[model samples]
Target: MRFGILVNEGPFNHQASDSAYKFTEAVLRKGHEVYRVFFYYDGVNNANKLSEPPSDDRHIVKRWSELAKAHNLDLVVCVAAALRRGMKDELLAEGFRISGLGQLIEAGIQSDRLVMFGD
Candidate 1:
């Protein structure tokens, strides 16, 4: 199956981001394709390159980047949401790109399932 993932929460502020990541990992491991992972609202924070959690905490942003690299996944941050949070192209982590909501729409149209995490 092909999936599109939408995340609407921040990495540390809620469990939504973590859940989305795990779900994506599991789906890929099951031989499914992820069309795209769209980060909207506070979820755009997942693309922030400057985020630094405590050493003991899992680095969610880095994990996303690594996952994208490993799978050649498209990790997209909503341009409007990112701009509202002061996230620019230079501030984005590896494997993440800033794009408009059209990408999300495209994902929904192309993927067999559109899985959303968070409100």
Candidate 2:
């Protein structure tokens, strides 16, 4: 099945981002397509290139980037939400792009299922 993922929470602040990532990974492993992964609200933080978690912690941002690269995934951060949180194109991690809500809408239209994580 084709899937669209929407994440509304920060990577470290909540488990939503982790859950979304795991779901995406599992779907890919199952040979399903992910139309897009839309990061909105605090979830936009997942694209922050400057995020520096402790060495012991899993690097969520890097994981997302690598996953996108491996699967040719579209990892999109909501432009409005990102701007509000001081995230710009240059600040985005590799494999992530800043786009508008239209991308999310397009994902919903194109994918068979729209899976959302977080509130």
Candidate 3:
């Protein structure tokens, strides 16, 4: 199956990001394809390249970055939401890009299922 994930909250503030990450991993492990992982609202924080979590704690941003790299994932941060949150183009991680809402709409239209994690 083809999946599209939509995240709506910032990393660390809620379980939404973590859940999305785990679900994405599980889906890939099951041999399903993830068409796109779109970050919206505060979720764009997940793509922040400057995030530095505690040494002993999980690095949410890095985790997502590595996951995207390993899977060749399409990780897109909503341009409007990311700009509002002060996430600049230069600060985006390797596998992430800032894009318009149309990208999200197109992903949803192309995927076999759209899963949303938020709050």
Per-residue CA lDDT of model 1 for 5-96, tens digit only, reads 99999998899999999999999999999999999999999998999999999999999999999999999999999999999999999999
1-119: candidate 3 lDDT, tens digit per residue:
99999999999989999999999999999999999999999999999889999899999999998999999999999999988889989999888999999999999999999999995
If scored against the real structure, what TM-score would every candidate get? 0.98, 0.98, 0.97
Provide the clash count, candidate 1. Answer: 0
Better TM-score candidate (1, 3): 1
Ordering by lDDT: 1, 2, 3
lDDT of 3 at 104: 93
Q: Against the correct fold, how does model 3 do in TM-score? A: 0.97
Better model by lDDT: candidate 1 vs candidate 3: 1
Considering TM-score, where higher is better, how would the candidates rank from best to worst?
Answer: 1, 2, 3
lDDT (10s digit) by residue, model 2, range 53-73: 999999999999999999999
Candidate 2 Cα misplacement greater than 4 A, ranges: none
Give the lDDT of residue 80 in candidate 1: 97
